[model samples]
Target: MSVINYGQLLQLAWPEIILTVAALIALAADLLFFRQSALRTRFLVAASIASIGCIAAIFKLLPGSSEGMLLGGVFLSNPATHLVQIALLVIAILTLFLSVDSTFTDHVGEFVLLILLATTGMMFLVASQDLLVIFISLELLSLSVYILAGFDKRSSRSAEAALKYFLFGGMSAAFMLFGFSLLYGFSNSTNLVQIASAIHAVPLNPLVILAIVTTVIGFGFKIAAAPFHFWAPDVYQGAPTPSAAFIASGSKVASFFIFFQVLVIGFAGAEGSATLHHFQSGWVPVIVTVAVASMLLGNLVAITQTSLRRLLAYSAVAHAGYMLLAYVAHSEQSLAALLYYVATYALATLGIFGILTVTEKQLGNDKISDLAGLSRRAPFLSACLFIFVLSLAGIPPLSGFFAKFLLFTAVLAVSPGSKLLIGLIIFAIGMSAVSLYYYLRVLKSAFVADPPADATPIQSPMLLQLVVGLLAAGVVALGCAPDLILNQILKVIHASGL
Candidate 1:
């Protein structure tokens, strides 16, 4: 925390700094140079700049480094953190590419700028261990996304989605902030490690219990867990497609990672237990209840959805539940498994939305039936959709399949004798089966059903198709070779002791 160490703050935060610079540059370029250009031209230029900035930040993270924590953990850099940040940037860059063809808003520069700003927030959110920094980063990301959701000013649905997102997000922030205040009051420190040390001395006091519930409630909303997921279906259906994609992909990665950190590191000794017939009073049980509710509700409701976006939104809630299983298990391996599951999940959802962007434009709606005979109209995209959905459904030799496999394996490894753990895993597996039915329903529309008599062939932008193709290939590559990313994640976790 010395002055010279403060000097290293810039070095530690170079990725976020680069992203901010990129955002400003994009804004300026759009205002000064492309003010009257065609909308496509503006989007092309802005996306190129934004993509370069993301690539630069990724390169900055490429070199190996010993872990560093500066500014009393307000800034942190390590291999594990870098990996997650890289994943976030990748998702952002893909989203940027996906947006190039969108006509939702003519403010091309502003759109790109907000994407970069949101990426910057996610980078900081995943890297920092300080509660204050985390809160600021969350708000930064949230505010940008709220605006982006309502970016299509011409649409009443867009405006409504943005309002609901903002209101719920504000309430969640307040809850999280109050929880942080309680933690700070108890520990007299804003640092997570310090807070953990303090709490270890008086594990699960009434105040700490309050803090845990409030904090979980706050994060639950972010991850779109059940009972707090009122905004997701609307946002998914109403927001600009690219905005929805970013919210589902990059934000999920950063939020879940930090949530894990707060619980496993900051609330270490208060895990209690979620074992069946041996339930304990702690955060674990709270997580277990949310997970169970999310799994059941998300899957069942998705079965009734006709709209693709709402179906995916409900599916996202179910996926959130599955990812929370990692929290319940709370093991080193579970962390790795969670990252893999969430990362692959993000890629799959991004591709789905990318396709939806094109299909919705071509068909004038995003209903499942609207995609009828997609295999005939846009064979390549239909194929990609097949891959993305099956991956999400956890089909074999696909990344989603492996992600669930590893996650379930990790949870079972912890207290295999615990009936509660076994039952939860069984329930998760059953829900995965239920998820397959709905996902297959999508495929049936695209492949098995016939299109309307007046239907025309769908034509998507080359850039959009390229982005979606890459996402699909990524899903396939990661699934066929699970170790490609998982090994690196494990190595980083082991090295960083995270």
Candidate 2:
């Protein structure tokens, strides 16, 4: 034996450790360097450098060593971890942009700490191979997000959002804990792989089904899938735009990854045949209903909204529906579609929200009509925003179209007998078509309408704009190079067998 040691675990978690250490370094740098508000641009540059360095640590895992690579079996660095970590890194960069103009310079160091802490929690959450560890990591992320969401303590809505989030989030967590207890009882194991094997070995009973349902609902709350989604709009509207962006991108995406991990690795092994044979019928309907509801609610409610920020809030909820289209699919094809969709969605959403935060400052709280004829004032800025909106609307050649198409095609492939799939496909197509109306409404206001006589087109910082460029390019590139992106998803899927 080559003396199994702690060093292996540390190596596995090097990226997360690097990020945490960087955050502390940034904090000390802020304290030491500041005679006045650390020069915004200079401080931001440093922070960006540190954040990128943190993400670079993730690159080490891309070559993926999967022989129980971390924590002597307590942790893992399998292909699933690789793909999810990549997603997490991309979202972290987006958060950097989202906060660049918000509080990065003034309270410069503190926001970075919060972001890193939250992200660290996410890293642990995804890497965890046991339910107990996953729960602990989840709380770490949740507590950090709860605070961040209400960082603007002066705002009543921010406070209210935090409270509402806590209540609902807490309730869901309780259900999750209870479900975990039931699962531990039934399967006699907390280790995800073993529990999954146990569940798969036996027919899924009422208790097992309850455990699964409650667990889904718990994660559902995190992801803003409907019924559990009531908190998202209020929270998004109330939270600082940057925090909202992180919450929207990082929190949901991380939860999605964990939800996926817990299910696939916990209960979806080969023995999963027995469990899946029973649960698929039950869960599919519920997922479809939530998905359809989210789409309609998001798009329909968004039309009447006057504020651009609020509209985007609803738009995020609707987009949640689109993302869920991948999950409702009970097959690997749908999952690969999901992987592609989320990757595209992550970059595009981050870019759009990053721009939103910047412009909100200049335009003074984005109202739809206020955006009248934006192209005339800042054609470039308007064009960038247009690209984002078009992507959101699923216009072809943009990443959004490809993501939607992949999801639809995947779902369609699984549609042979399930009437639910047929109905879902129709709903998905109709919803896609219906979304054009609201997205176009924004576009028309941008290009066709007249600019506000007083307001000028806002200019974005070069780095932030560069980030936007990267995301826009990513959106298109993902569409054009579907196989490349899909391949990573497939490998992860194969490893996890989701």
Task: Specify the highest-TM-score model's number.
Answer: 1
Clash list (residue pairs), candidate 2: 196-266, 372-450
* Superposed model 1: Cα runs more than 4 Å off: 1-4, 65-67, 201-203
Computed on alpha carbons, the lDDT of every model, listed in order, comes to 0.92, 0.74
- Tens digit per residue, CA lDDT, model 2, 1-498: 235467777777787887788878777777677536536653575467557756675666566543354432357777777777768876876677556656423566676778888888988887877888899999999998998878786678888988888888899999999989988997787788777767654445767777777887888788887678888878877888778788877777678777766765675632221123444433444566678888888888888887766777778778878777666665788777776776677777677777776667777766777678778766666777787888888998888888889888887786566666677778877887888888898889888987766766567777677777777777778767777678878877787645
Model 2 has an lDDT value of: 0.74
For model 2, the stretches where C-alpha displacement exceeds 4 angstroms are 1-5, 39-46, 64-73, 103-105, 200-203, 269-281, 415-417, 495-498
lDDT of 1 at 243: 96
Question: What are the per-residue Cα lDDT tens digits for candidate 1 across 199-288?
Answer: 864336888989999999899999999988999999999999999999999999999999999999889888877665666667898999
TM-scores of the models, in the order given: 0.98, 0.90
